[model samples]
Target chain A: MPEITYRDAVQKAIADEMRLDDSIVFFGEDVAKAGGVFKVTPGIYEEFGAERVRDTPISEQAIIGTALGAAITGLRPIAELMFADFIPVAMDQIVNQVAKYRFMSGGQFTVPLTIRAAQGGGGGFGTQHSQCAESWLMNFPGLKVVAPATPLDMYSLLRAAIRDDNPVVVLEHKYLYTLKGEVPADASPGSIGEAKVVREGADLTVVALQLMLHRALEVADKLADEGINLEVIDLRAVAPLDSETILRSVMKTNRLLMVEESPRQGGWGASVASMIADRGIYHLDAPIKRVNMENSLIAYSPVLEDEIIPNAGKIEKAVRDLLAED
Target chain B: MTTDSIARLDRDARLKALNTMTTIRLAEEEIQNLFMANLVRGTTHLAIGQEACSAGVAQALRPGDSMTCTYRGHGHALALGMTLRAMMAEMMGKASGACKGRGGSMHMTDQSIGLLGANAIVGAQLPIAMGAALTAQIKGSGAIAVVFFGDGATNIGVFHESLNMASVWKLPVLFICENNLYGEYSPVRATTPIDDLAERAAAYGMPGVIVDGQDIEAVYSATLAAAERARAGDGPSLLELKTYRYRGHSRADTGPYRAPGELDEWLKRDPIDLLLGRMIAAGEIDQAEYDEMRGAIEKAVVEAIEWAQAEPFPELEAADDYVYYPG
Candidate 1:
């Protein structure tokens, strides 16, 4: 099926997991032989040479503490952070050493480590290289985060965040890296806190992620030609937040909305509207609208970056103001 | 005596470096009497007079080499062999700990003896021991790592981005530093402007040296000549050592900004009384077999603090076991 390009499905999910894990490797700043400044890692440093695709030193905390010290001594690495707004120059190697080294070494270390980074907003690289840093990494809990809107979930969630043992992150979306799709040359990966629902419709739900899940599927295909359908979903991994498929699509679309692109203060759509108002608030009939972006600063000017980011006409006006409050 | 591992320190490697510097000075005096009987909680940082830079860089590494120190690492986790009842059951937090108590005592890990932890942060274990020496220079695994910091993590920034990416990837790694001249109390000439922190390893071109860190054969001959120039791939070196920290950066910091006879001048270089006065003047032990090998290492640090204070403290639903990686 090879129709590729979410930057060739993140360079075929990191050259198909460094050709089935020769314990993975890869590094950052111009990921080797000067390929990735968003060239996504061209020819993986001429097919994994320079000792597994090397090239580092722009040292974001020694590229995430040498990918949490080569994932606790065995080596899985990956690293890259060319810009997830330089994750606060490596927030103490991703919140105190790759999320507290396997719970403060209690499990004696497992950090298979992946990292990647690029993040969202639609280029204009303003406000510290555009924004959406998956709500500054879903507030930490040993970091998983994901974010791929498609070239098949960026080749199955970056081959499930480089075969997840733990420290994941990924992000991508510098405007869905050339978008495209088809994928399947062994695509697989679905569950890092699942949430696909892609289109369906009972008249509301929405949710969104990465380029606001393609502007909530172009506002659910132009509100399914006025019959007002909607549904959407696509979240893909904001720290295991499937929230049981957005509370079973808000108990048959009783109207949720969210949509984001960062900044409704502490966003991943305010933890999916505080987990659907703490346990799908009587299976939502309204009050969860979100639409986000204005916490300010994006501004490079594609009309002040499309007047504060959201779009598909602000998810069809927050899905017609939550289907006119049901 | 320059790197034939300091004329191969024999006499049972100088009485196993005076029984690993008297089991790291009786496990930092039983982790300062288990933090004065409150049986250890938060802050500890001891390295009591540095124990010959963790018994001379864990006697020049070896067993699939790996390390990463600081939080004044209980003398590099008892010079890399770990045990003393899994570091006093992870400084008494228990459940048979070397991390079963979820890494107490500034996160000490054992990783079956490679001790891949002990980082309370300062210089963040030199980019995770330069990423475990770039995983032994990409799994040709002649393994080498060694980190240890201090001299206030040489004014950190991931210690100059882990020594400029471990000397532009010659990797393997050794870095040491233990220049305990005081980072936690502010002494290395008022937060170091350089009275030699091994000349910041010449802005990362490696080979820095400066040892005598209370000697353990001059830090096992400059960490066995920088771990054989990082297992012959020739990279990373910065040794430093120049030790001291008889205490005070944590738990009862009697350091009172020491200047008054600077703790009797580093307690007159007491690295286990200068290797038991050079194994009792080279006649090899005599103060009655050095008081029966320090009364059997203080009866094995008082039976590893009464078997880590009769163990068991972890089961609060195992505090949601190791935060992640369960699958």
Candidate 2:
């Protein structure tokens, strides 16, 4: 009934879940009085008291470790690491402990925790503050990684991650927080490991994750003017990849193009490409092309940063090259 | 509160404490033999001289309360009522083990017994214990979480984070640090600037108590008070058990770091012997009864080792089986 911004949708999802479940709590540096650096947690402390909406000390290791501890014990804690770049300090907890607890315990335990942080670079935050680490987390076995690009996806995915039994890493694009989209009034929280086909076409399938999905959609619209139809698939979740949906699309289009904001080497796009090559290689008429960030640190300068990341223009050109091949 | 209270314990509680310590001692002896005989694989950290802390604390806990332990966790697991057979089987990598042989000696766990796990990483269990306490608080289960770590863990950042959160939320947790004075090859003096680990708790605005870890009665009394305060929701307590480890940090360690006379000094204060002396002096048990208890525990330990050696290793294909991806 009402159009909400992506930031508001995230806040509403946490507020609603906190209302429904007393075990749900939020904690991060500056999250309490500041309501999050991006304001995604505004009014949460006022609504849920200080205990539920905790403001933790400036320790990423503790932020993640405390969340893991709280999650495994009983409470559902959504811990925010102020920025995605700061996650390296807590990688041991996220990768070794939180990700391996279920498997290590032979399914005897579950780490029902959610780690939310803003990712991506567009606001000239420099190399240290701007990073997309979803691919790094996807390498682990017991973790579920998600990055929501739209208001609807953000709300539904955040809610799903909070409710899931396994540990989840929700990478919210810092640049997309203010973007608005139409969300259904009564839309139920969506499932993990499913891809959403935002635009349908017959020529080629362009798979994108997080904010790149919006760029892919924009490129799909531009390519339509030239009578070149393109199918845009949004990879809502990374770890439990929707291989079936991706294969089905690849079988129809016979060409694949994956775009990601992470480094090209060992990026999540590599996994998708390898999956298609392994399962649906015979369905392809041309090679699968990937558009990703350069395999280097993000530059501090805006011009250099822009050149490092993949944009709609690059996705469009990659699709055209793949289609041009006989 | 009084010296008489320090010297006195209920008959059943004293027996339970002694039995727990005996179980852990025998279990460690069995594990050592099995490890040397090549029946069990992987590194092992034995809690031989540090039995009092685990036994005393575990004896104070109810069935529903939970515990998180460090690599030196055989005592913790055995004290929490995890069958010696399961623990031995786990070390031997058998499917009959508590974690279905997925976890080894340092990772032993029995959720049914409220033993969350024996984490290998130092100081890693602090936050986890806090989380479990948070769970207990939220569910109103009246349960508490006891975290067992070493003096070495005090230097780790997770230790501070866990303490801060535990005190801030007043979560039902008992942060027990077994200050054995050594963190692997390095002694605590070489690593930390503080003389007393208990004093560090004062920074977090909670009560910190240091007790004679080699005395079972002292450890039991201190832990009981801490557990009672936790259950009453008074807040978390930091109990520093001043103890010593008879063995090296791990199997690979030769323990050359200790002075020549330190081991003998600690052996004089053996917790099991102290408990036995008290029991005998009070006429709680005769020499014959003590011999029978010791014999039974020895028999159990022998059977556990035999069972573990007879067990088979897990199949290689099973390695990737439990990597969960909830579709």
Tens digits of per-residue lDDT, candidate 1, B30-140, equal 788778777677778777777888887898789989898887788788888888888888887888888888778888888888888988878888888888888888887
**TM-score for each predicted model, relative to the true structure:** 0.43, 0.95
- Give the local distance difference test score of model 1: 0.83
State what share of the real interface contacts each candidate retains: 0.88, 0.57
Model 2, A224-291: lDDT tens digits are 99999999999988988889889999999999999989888998889889999899999999998889
Best by DockQ: 2
Best by TM-score: 2
Cα RMSD, model 1 = 18.2
lDDT of each: 0.83, 0.86
TM-score of chain B of 2: 0.96
